[model samples]
Target: MSRVDSNNERLMILSDVTKVYPMGDTQVEALRGVNLQIKSREFIAVLGPSGSGKSTIMHILGCLDTPTSGTYHLDGAAIQGLNPNELAEIRNRKIGFVFQSFHLLPRATACENVELPMVFAGINATDRKACAERVLDQVGLKERTRHLPNELSGGERQRVAIARALVNRPSILLADEPTGNLDSRSGAEILALFEELHTEGRTVILVTHDEMIASRAQRVIRILDGRIGQGSSDNHGRKE
Candidate 1:
């Protein structure tokens, strides 16, 4: 959450990162010596299939999990050894997450759902409402602010979810399978919205199994069997 990168240059750095899980009598490696760097305003995609460890990378990038070994620096501050509370603060204040499921409160109105993050962060009701409304407008859901999740279409619900993610104005937008639940038309619309956000200078990191979806990003890093793949095979098989 602290802005250690005063030069405003790099946003994230990972060096020889690894993650291993204890599974009964055996150990499972989810990440293997991953090294990566992300600058502010970059749009990146972690492209992989199930069990390829892309999600683990996302979790580490979002500060939801720590690397089992190696270092991770965000905003130029080393984060590998931070406590859970510290990590939670970082996740809440610096990372905006979009999941395959819309993850909105079923009973809350769209505006209220978007306001939830700020509410937890102790923002006043007035400010939360205003910020939520503004982001909803940005995501093309201004008129549907009062609609509940069940009252809106699939695309509209996802828009509300995105509005919530943007309300924090976090340092990075990390999306995991963001378009997985939508139809092709709606998914394309969502991708366009993300493009618009990237244009506005937000750091966007998309994690998805679909190669076509990853192709939309400016850069793609493929993962396979818990390790970064060696590939000149860029998005959609286009050479970079």
Candidate 2:
């Protein structure tokens, strides 16, 4: 049987994208004329200052928000004007999210937290359990599957979050400040895991403000005042 990924076209495409938000009589442009493309297995870092629109770009790429203008294409599907349901479908099937806070339920065990998305997607009980367990194991949390969020260390909790993000086999992994809350050692471990995932041919977009961490990515995109800064590149190593 042919692998499903053999059919993958370009993973993502964005052209002249701009996102504007209206507040009272003023309009704030969160993203301005952003043009970008990401291939199937690239590791990219979106780097910028606090108000520089890195998060905005991540949201648009993850299908959580639509651009006010211009076009977006994900895995060959045009997403310019897709409605909420369509956007949700694309997010569920193609994008996985990892945030700095982990976002695990305080009362739920690690396995249960990892299984929530599959449950929402109507996966069978047995399949959900198996899938969650496998992913937790992948994130090195097999022994802590039964522990609740408060019982795990910071690193372990983030690992659980990563497991939850990976449970659905999504085509793209979006990590927003993934190591922000961890110490240097733990952050290093998480970065190593990202590199491992990249080596395994996953499309990983890491959003961060730290230059050291951003440098670890194969390509780095820096945004400033809602516009692309100098670091944006067409090829991984090419500036133009």
Candidate 3:
């Protein structure tokens, strides 16, 4: 596998970021002064146990939420204060998300499921179908394009999810515990596919709690107590 070159352009920067949530009369800080940088074409894992605020970080990175304090710059554009509609636009244009649950619509075929994002983006039927088939072929699911989720195996379903994620050709592919529901063999296949995508120059950020899973990335960022710890290291134990 090709590693992320240190000279790659910077894709994202988080400066002293923080996130807060309100509960009744109490306020909870989900992230506390976290700073991070990610480069284009980098495959990295955000590793954290439950309640460590990794999900908050993911939300911020994915443009699903904004920071409570500090600044986030994606591709040189400030992201901390964008409105919901603006954020949604950025998400549709720049980020692709894959979740553990393989959120495929039960009534849709693989091709139709992959075409949903383009449908939202107002892509016409012909282009949507073409792009969907192209990505499904890229993900090794061309033959299964007509199959529904229930007709596929766990790995195949996840592949369809991946195809859906990639159909937009987003700059960053963010996967949250992507293999959490798969058997070991299927999970390995998905990881291999991720590596393949990384080699093809896609920026992949995998948010996972499993050490073994995190270890597959080129670098790992560990979060604890809503803060980025000193344990952010490469696979060889070098600080990133």
Number of the top-ranking candidate, with TM-score as the measure: 3
lDDT of 3 by residue, 1-240 (tens): 135444676799999999999989999999999999998888899999999999889989999999999999999999977888899888888999898999999999999999999988999999999999999999989899999999999999999999988888897999999999999999999999998988888999999999998988988999999999887887734424
Per-model TM-score, in order, reads 0.91, 0.91, 0.93
Superior by TM-score: candidate 2 or candidate 3: 3
- What lDDT does each candidate get? 0.88, 0.88, 0.91
Ranking by TM-score: 3, 2, 1
Candidate 2 shows a clash count of 0
Over 129-162, each residue of candidate 1 has an lDDT whose tens digit, in order, gives 9999999999889899998899998889888988
Q: Candidate 3, which ten residues in sequence have the lowest lDDT sum?
A: 1-10
Candidate 2: regions farther than 4 A off = 1-9, 233-240
Relative to the true structure, candidate 3 reaches a TM of: 0.93
Q: What residue pairs clash in candidate 2, if any at all? A: none
Instruction: Point out the higher-scoring one by TM-score: 1 or 2.
Output: 2
Backbone clashes for every candidate come to 0, 0, 0
10 residues in a row with least lDDT, candidate 1:
231-240
Q: Give the TM-score of candidate 2.
A: 0.91
- What RMSD does each model have against the real structure? 4.2, 4.3, 2.9
